[model samples]
Target: MDKRKKTSQMQERAMKTMPLGVNSNGRYWGKKVTPYFQRGKGAYVWDVDGNQYIDYRLAFGPVILGYAYDEVDEKVISAIRDGVTPGITSQLELEAAEKIVELCPATEKVRLVNGGSDATQHALRVARAYTGKEKIIKFEGGYHGSYDYVLFSTYAPPSTYGNSRSPITVPASSGIPSALGDLIITLPFNNLEILEATLKRCGNEVAAIITEPMLGNFGCADPLPGFMDGVRRLCDEYGIVWILDEVKTGFRIAKGGAQEKYGYQPDITTYAKALGNGYPVAAYGGKAKIMDIVGQGVTQGGTYAGNAVAAAAAKATLEIMSTQNVHGYIDAMGSRLQNGLRAIFKKAGIPCLLSSMPAIFSVSFGIESNLDAREWAKADASIYKKIAARAFEKGILIDEDPREPFCMSYSHTEKDIDDTLEIFDEIVRTL
Candidate 1:
């Protein structure tokens, strides 16, 4: 009997009902490689086959404190005891919103949502309503959500995105209407000259410029020194709303997210992932002037937007973040792991670029610099995929896709980092 016999059998059974035997397309890595996790704890997970792994993916950056963190889970359970959603707002919801307003420098008012997609979708709608414009500008690799308006140019080859000066809008999904693409202007990130030119031409017609502070979905590429400031200035000059999408970088990067770390404020911001420590909770808010438009002819509401469970989870998570040195500890862990990996890759004679912050970063092989998604795409992703696959087999888990980043949790220790480096060195030696 194979060690993965149960996992393989479960996949076969799941394929009978679900598409590709997984709920999310990214979860499918083919029948042979895809794993089914039974449970998770601090910094680790166990597959259905009973194989243990040191998990670095962290469920795509949600389990910031660690999986099943007691502080957050206890709050959630207490809220559940009170009831989940009682058809109206609760005290827990208010506390969560208040915490967000207190921590996030740009967020004066907030509206909780079910997930990242909901937060980004409503942020765009508020921008349109506030500016009285229909068109929006998103970067080539920026992925706001699954919404039709934002599902353009993400995960597509750089060659298909047309010229850098005037890029093409390529739809990421089939069901999204073609007309929605017309409203979106996709531009190459980190190119301030092109952005300035585009804004000069038709910035008035554009309602909002939604962007991730860093290319979270594209190998965690950081913004150039002056690029973010340039965007803020351009948006202000053109009277266009600047929306910072911090779904991945929100709580993981810092207490106040990228806006705090970067020292520039946007008109609006979206947050999720680490807000609830793995619970489905999200929010979008910014200047009071912009968020106030929500009730005035601009609609944004959901039945489960600020439900008790989500609210309690967020409140607890934020409270812990405010009181403790969560970021400090995680930063140390991240720095250690990143330095170890860098040394290992160097010793193996592999040239790699490690991008973004210590908490959430990416490794791009055979590339010296990754300024934007196009440059990031030029890296040898096949090698990364192979490394990730091999790492999984050796009881280490990382995202196989090169675009996704390696997420670190507060639970990760120095021992974990040392062990990971040892395994990576062994794997790199073979390569």
Candidate 2:
């Protein structure tokens, strides 16, 4: 133990009934670390132990405008004062959806949901209903959400997964019924030939081809030239819906998202994370032709879908993102952080490399470089564990899962970047 985590009497007292002494396992920092967030501000987080760290996780991408942003807080507070969950729709919902459609040119219609999972799950349902098919083609590592069909595969390659070319599917978590494995056709990342082949064989049964546009969960893998175009063609050739799971990369990648960045649009796109800052909100819809299915009782509704609080927060977030070059800031910050990490590896005599896409970045502990999910899975996850453990020893919070990409937020300043990089440099040298 680092001798810093002395549990408060309140914490000990609460643990008697609360499972794991906390609500979420993800929020728990480490064995020696229990991340009891006291407060957060401007790319930094404070734990129950009172240790402040420059937070690279960015509250798992929801804090895009940064923690406790004054403007956002004002909006949220205003909503809170008005009432967190109003019985009816707030004007903020209209404003937010309009902003999303405006930013995402492909979006002609939008339906708000609670979170990324809600957006993605509903997107799949809409696709299936629109196209009258049940199957979906999800990449080996691309994670959408906790829904059944999606849960069977999220960042699973190597280990239990066999044969990269025709990769086998594995369950991300236990509760996901094993039968879901059969419904999903898991494809290898960046392999257009195999992807095309798989779709050709089962395109008719497939309702939608859901992808992260840029295989985000697989170390921020950029799409190969014309790769997504090929995907679009296959979908069109078979009347399949091509839904972009931009829950992670949507607003963060660009104002129009990967579609704008890559110059190819999907039939539908899901939005969350950056959509609501830290509030609970998500949306999915595009090509009114397909979205029409949702209206005819194909179904998409939630008690909290357009709840007032989420609507207000999303509206405020969109307004801020639209008014400024938020994408530019994200791009620069990610580049700087990527370069800084690479410099540390070089100076430490470790042949490590960092891969990125503006806001999302990954540090490979073993491999010098890699192209896709299969390659990333082979990199040294154990080495990442070492680095993560050491970083936590100091006051830094990186995403603990090496397979998952770390992010850059607009809130992270030059000083925060410099200090974090310095710590990484020292840690790598010691390793």
lDDT (C-alpha, whole model) for all candidates: 0.92, 0.80
For this target, which candidate reaches the highest TM-score against the unseen true structure? 1
Q: How much does candidate 1 score in TM-score?
A: 0.99
TM-scores for all predictions? 0.99, 0.94
Tens digits of per-residue lDDT, candidate 1, 1-431, equal 68798999999999999999999998988877799989999999999999999999999999999989999999899889988989888989999999999999989999999999999999999999999998999998888987788988897888798889878899998899998887989999999999899988898899999999899999887889999989999998988999999999998899999988878799999999999999999999999988987888889889898999899999999999999999999999999999999998988889988998999999999899988878887899999989999999999999888899999999998999999999999999998
Task: Quote the positional error of residue 356 for candidate 2 in Å.
Answer: 2.1
* Each model's Cα RMSD: 0.8, 2.0
After superposition, the stretches of candidate 1 with alpha carbons farther than 4 Å from their true spots are: none
Question: Which tens-of-lDDT digit does each residue in 1-431 have in candidate 2?
Answer: 44464545435655787766777556554434556677898898887667888888886777887888888878878878877667677787888888888888788999988989889988999998888789988887787886777875574445666776677888887688888888788877677889778876777899998888766666777677788888898888899999988998888878787877777779999989878777778999799888887869887778888887788888888888889878798888778888888777877777676776758877786776566677777787888888988997788988787866787777888888789888888898888
In model 2, what are the clashing residue pairs, if there are any? none
